[model samples]
Target: MSLSPILDLAGLTLEVNHLARGVRFYSQVLGLELARHDEAAGVAEFVVNPHQTLTLWQPITRQANDERLAPLRPRGASHLHYAWQVEPSDLEPSKGLLDAHGLEWQEINLGTEDRPDWTLYFFDPFGHGLELRGVDRADARQPHFAPTPVQRPPHALPVMGLREVALAFSDYPTMKERLPRAYGFALAKEQEDRDFAQFTLGPHPEPDGNGTPRRWLYAWDPQVGLADMLGGDHALVRFYADVDAVGALVVAAGLPCLRDDHGLAVRDPEGHVFEFIAG
Candidate 1:
């Protein structure tokens, strides 16, 4: 059993300059179903999977007038890097889709010869970095979260849901220490050369099978290679977890915890917002 209260990444909200353009790219090109759109509020929500959401927000100047929303307003990072998990078979089709849209894409193999883990990297219309990761599975790994029935769009890229989200940190060491202490994250991988680290939350099974944790949180210095591409300073990253435990931990670690209608939230040193939602 995992001691961490965080179960999974619940949603991600990105800041976009043009809401319509963002919506068209995600819905028409990526095939994510648009769940809700509030034109007046300048927000669009897309169903990434049964349990996850991808939201686009166009910041309004008058948002400060609404006290309840001002704090919760989606001010996310620009050129943020996030990934979606796909089946190995879907990779080629994804390439075709990108090419058809005249979008430039790059592919990299992260796994070995016998088992290949391929990642296709591309950008959205707004320049947010996006990735499609596919791995050949000889043995099926047990899922950490229970399967929920969802109606996927026929033209969608067969995305399994969010695989990872990366955050650019101005002070990587401080943020790194606080995450494990406050959120019960265990360091899974470290690329010191790149000044990046991957952290895993909740119970992970082992060398193979059910022990492998699929979801990841990647933290890297903003000065690093791909991190430099991130234009915005902050983003709203949310997770499904025990709100009480998360709140307590945040306070104990000397981090400021803010609570509103959206549960508990804390800002990292770089101003990136982390919100915890009760499952």
Candidate 2:
């Protein structure tokens, strides 16, 4: 049964091998602010956005051996990559900034060879693939695809109005009891045989906002056990950007196109993957 109402998704949380390094990389490179840090606990939370948090912590020693770091190993392969969007104009300057920092980057064509929109790609310190894109493309020749909406909820809604997540959990009962209370997420619905459930994104319906509620799914599986639920070691951090901003940031980052068919992928120093998409 549902125990409490839905709360905002505060951000993604990840336990890293090196806390200090992660903090430095995110702050200096990505421009995330350090919301808070507990020196005694060695836990820090970076506010990626109003709704998103990048959490970092480290144990006395990491359990994963050198063998676990094998590039193509399946033991802990992350199937998904996150996409971060930037403004179109910001692409150039962003690439410049990245190049100054000694990071490699590239440009991308979103549509088919005959018709394509240029995009940018780079990696974070954790090997997470990140993309910066524009809200709309200028090339009339490029295939026309509708733009994804900007995902910001009203402030008046419930605890920050965070709605979407793809968490991996094991027990349904424990999650039913705990998640809603902690994250301000409500039980929009659930799917039993599919091994997952869903929560509404954004705040509860309010009088002024026109946006409809969106539902996000969370898949529970043995691979994503309870202990490994919150920080599954495999996560994608999404960044939002408009068309002009996408170009500015891309150029500043000095990145390159990933491939012809897909967005670019790069490795951060720690090896986590992030993919970028338009907001």
Candidate 3:
């Protein structure tokens, strides 16, 4: 039997040093509703779809002699790169909304002038990179990944569902080679601009017997690998699985896997953690 990890990218959880600031950006700026927030607990959830959500959390409380904190490193410090996909037409309106708020933003085109799909990028108060990618409504573009209009708070734009997220790495071959070995993700699409490689977790048996996630993981090397340009680590990925099968396969793969109160999880070569929760 051909083996796959039986994974999915249901949602992402980002860590912010300043929980209040993060919550403000995602709510007041992004226009996502504040579904639930517990400031005392330092965690908040934003609804995207009934199934998809964005969570902002703070570092777990530090204990005495926490091994998680290295000699010189800060406790639970994380830098992440994240993106939300939206329809092409929303681009100009979204830009206008951001400008109206006096937020600094910039655009970078990933395609030709006549065939542009631009990405608008900015940052949160603590420096976590945030992106909004516009995928044109062309037949060649996977409609499944194209984001549709989402319900938003009266304060912000109609931020849609996630379509693509990019990770920057120092070595292409290492990531390209390890992705399949560590997990079942493999190259699914290519960019004509030669800026990045797209990997995906194909449809698998949804653990809950419901809709599976349609998502993409992009790896950008060398040209954009500069530390100041991209971020990694502290990004969340939810994978639904046949627990028995995944547990056995994880042990068999022996690829730095871990478990917690949630479920099994494994990180990509770049230290970006993926949390495998129940389908």
Candidate 4:
């Protein structure tokens, strides 16, 4: 079989209670440029990088007669966990900004003692868990993990792009098997206890060197590690992939999937929605 049709993570959407407050927190506080905001649609999009976007969506209550807007309306998840890639030099400035806004944050080292990669963990106004990851590029595990430089204004945070997005499942065993079997994701790393795993999609620059994939998805059992505190109900994740090829694999695997002219969407056992769009 060929490698997974998934190219990379295209975008992430968070469900927010207030669209205006969400816009202020992401734009004024985090320094992300508000690319577009549609009040009628109750959606706001922020450009994370050239290929990636972060969106905040306020779900509207559907009326009994509003069947036409059902397919067009998207639902978002709350209290989800996601991370952004930042330069090492921006770590202190990030703290300053978070402090200035009176937001409480915690600093931790996710890397080794000799080569430490610091991460700041904090919550948005809506209780969504967010991370600012300053990685050490010299780490031997990911030699090919080079992020493109993003030109930002003076007030903007030094965010390069998204590093990873995590999802917690009630049935970890099924997710462990189904994601790889249906999506062509390669197992990159896993915990000794088998409660958490990291799956990688897309190809690497050097197929023979280091063996690190371009993008990652972190999956874990509910109530394990950070998922215990940050996991939300029914979050939606979107990716850039070959929709037709992925849809074929999902059908061949006997899993339920929805297909249309735009893209393919599938739901896991835990109700997490995975939407694949053609790149």
In model 1, which runs have C-alpha deviations exceeding 4 angstroms? 64-69, 72-74, 135-143, 146-155, 204-213, 224-232, 260-262
In what order do the candidates fall by TM-score, top score first? 1, 4, 3, 2
State which candidate, 1 or 3, has the greater lDDT. Answer: 1
Global lDDT of each model? 0.71, 0.42, 0.60, 0.71
lDDT of 3 by residue, 1-279 (tens): 254554445666676877788888888888776788877666788887655677777766653112321222222224566666666677778888888878778887756777665767877677667777664445333323344577776558666776545666677777776665555555665556665667664443111101112456767763443225464553555655545566665567665666666676665446555556666
Residue 100 miss distance in model 2 (angstroms): 0.9
Residue-level lDDT of model 2, residues 1-279, one tens digit each, is 532222223344454556688787766766666887665455677765444556564443333321222231112223222334344555667677777668887776655676555656665555444455453333322111212233232211011122334544456566554434433344556654655655543234221111222323353443532212232334433322232333334334443313112232322222333233333
Give per-residue lDDT, candidate 2, residue 189.
Answer: 60
RMSD of each: 3.4, 17.5, 6.1, 4.0
Where does model 4 exceed 4 Å of error? 63-74, 136-146, 204-213, 227-229
- Give the lowest summed-lDDT range of ten residues in model 1: 204-213
How far off is residue 272 in model 4, in Å? 1.4
Q: Is candidate 1 or candidate 4 better by TM-score?
A: 1
Steric collisions counted per model: 2, 74, 0, 0
Segments in model 3 whose C-alpha atoms lie over 4 Å from true places = 1-8, 60-77, 136-146, 168-172, 189-196, 203-214, 221-228, 240-248, 256-262, 267-270
Q: Please give the lDDT score at residue 49 for candidate 2.
A: 47
lDDT of 2: 0.42
The TM-score of predicted model 4 comes to 0.84
In terms of lDDT, model 1 sits at: 0.71
